[model samples]
Target: MLTSVYRLVRPRQFELVFNDITLDKSHVIVHPVRLSICNADQRYYQGLRAENILRKKLPMALIHEAVGRVAFDPTGQFEEGTLVVMIPNTPTEKDDIIAENYLRSSQFRASGFDGFMQEYVSMEPDRLVALPEDVNLSVAAFTEIVSVSYHTIQRFLRFSHSRRDVIGVWGDGNLGYITSLLLKAILPETKVCVFGVNEYKLHDFSFADDVYLISDIPEDFHMDHAFECVGGAASSKAINQIIDYINPEGTISIMGVSEDFAPINTRMILEKGLRLFGSSRSGREDFLGLIKLYNQNPDLINQLEKIVGAEIHVRSIQDITRAFEIDIHKIMGKTIMIWEN
Candidate 1:
């Protein structure tokens, strides 16, 4: 048995639990796993599904996106030492629950299965991807978050008519910056504009060419595509702002998770012929593409340094809950976690 760490959540509380992982005697033993905590949180903690599988009246570990290294794997595909990232999404292993369709039934590692906050973790060899030497552990920690942008952008491009479309991303948070970068990376000719609350965050990334602080938005700007990464009432207002600027027949991809309802202009949505949708954890292919980008561009670590606001080691599980309660802006570009064994 190996000792590991896991985060847990309830309707209104957060906790951490130490876990024991054991391999069946028949399974081969693999060694030395590298693990790190993540900065992102789960969408919801209470639901019917949460009660069934985890058997937890409360939820388990909130963070879903992170990067780690595989110390060992029996298959030899992942050897003793490999810098890798885990794609949290996993297909349902349950045979009894037939998903109406594969898309409807897919599961995720941190969501419904085991997650990565631990002293050691044993993962499937095929699930791991070795990182490039240039990728630092801290910046690489955001590989999953970065992929969220990549996946969202690809979805828009795949469904849109033009590759050179103009895109306006709402919010200048880390996700917003990465979304712009991913679009620029894939569609270099695409015009990228950003809506952010803080002018500083907007300037942090070179790719957000046209940035605005809601108060000074350009009314005439037209968008073929837009992304919603703001997660509060403020963000909802930003979404409304996006609606004002989008062109007729435009598409808005919402990837941010919010706790409040921001009214949408239903009439204008119809009048503008808008197609708005949301995205959560990404697909396997998107994660793979993120890895490829991390490998190809050595400077991502440096560029990403601005987004990882701070780092906090886990002294106790209680700290995890407190971590989230603190102002997120104070910790912008920072990562908080309990690091002790």
Candidate 2:
């Protein structure tokens, strides 16, 4: 039997994936689920439109971040009621459409598959994560973004020795704050400095050792390593700035996606002998480590709550456009969709 799955679609554009499939035999057939829409982005939609028209291809699916309950799992690793985060990455679940024929194939369940914006969703048993007893399922929605930071840090830390080293972060958005949180937790002795646009965006970042409003590097401050959490032209500028001021041999880990092309100062990079790296999804080991770290230091999680901007109900999925506006206004730190009982 086929189940109905709702998707956010644009006219001749990409649809969000929310897979609904039948099990051979299962105790529960339908599970009501919730999906967090990462603020509706008109620019993103426009970009998709332009790409489609340019390439003469139809539009694609939208959602890349989400968390949901188990719908069906015959093997019993995931029960119908367990709360979990979906790892949209391919390697963790090889059966994913993207992984089957390499990422070039867009057949994955969430990224390319049907997403979780509907009343019911069908996901593989292994895709479900049993949330810890103490973790609130609602807030757990940020897990995917946190995992992005986790994976980015894992790559940067591979080169560093002690947490006492100082790290620089460019951009003060959700990813930047979370990246700092992960770094501070792992390297308690490390001092972090975050640079961003407005004072309001950087307020929660009072925890940072230093906060810079100006984009240029200060004379006194020198970074052992740097992270570019803002994508686009700003990220490219930050990359060049880091290359100019970063301590010789330091590494740069880029976490955010970019829209416009930015020139990289290859001359400075080669002169400084810097180590630049890029990471996509967090490995299973990275997620497990983050979970362990979160469990040990719940305070970090508490701090993260400060940046959490809004908790609107899932029933308001249609209001995602308004949600996006709220986020852009900086009225909400991290916007989450509440899945009600």
What is the alpha-carbon lDDT of model 1 when measured against the actual structure?
0.63
Report model 2's TM-score to 2 decimal places: 0.82
**How good is model 1 by TM-score?**
0.81
lDDT (tens digit, per residue) of candidate 2 on 147-203: 768867776766753433788888888778888878788777888989888677788
Per-residue lDDT tens digits for candidate 1, residues 136-216, read 666666677787777777777766556356888887776777787777777768788888878877887686567888788
Ten consecutive residues with minimal summed lDDT in candidate 1? Answer: 25-34
Where model 2 places Cα greater than 4 Å from the true spot, the runs are: 11-20, 25-34, 39-49, 53-61, 92-110, 160-164, 215-217, 320-332, 339-341
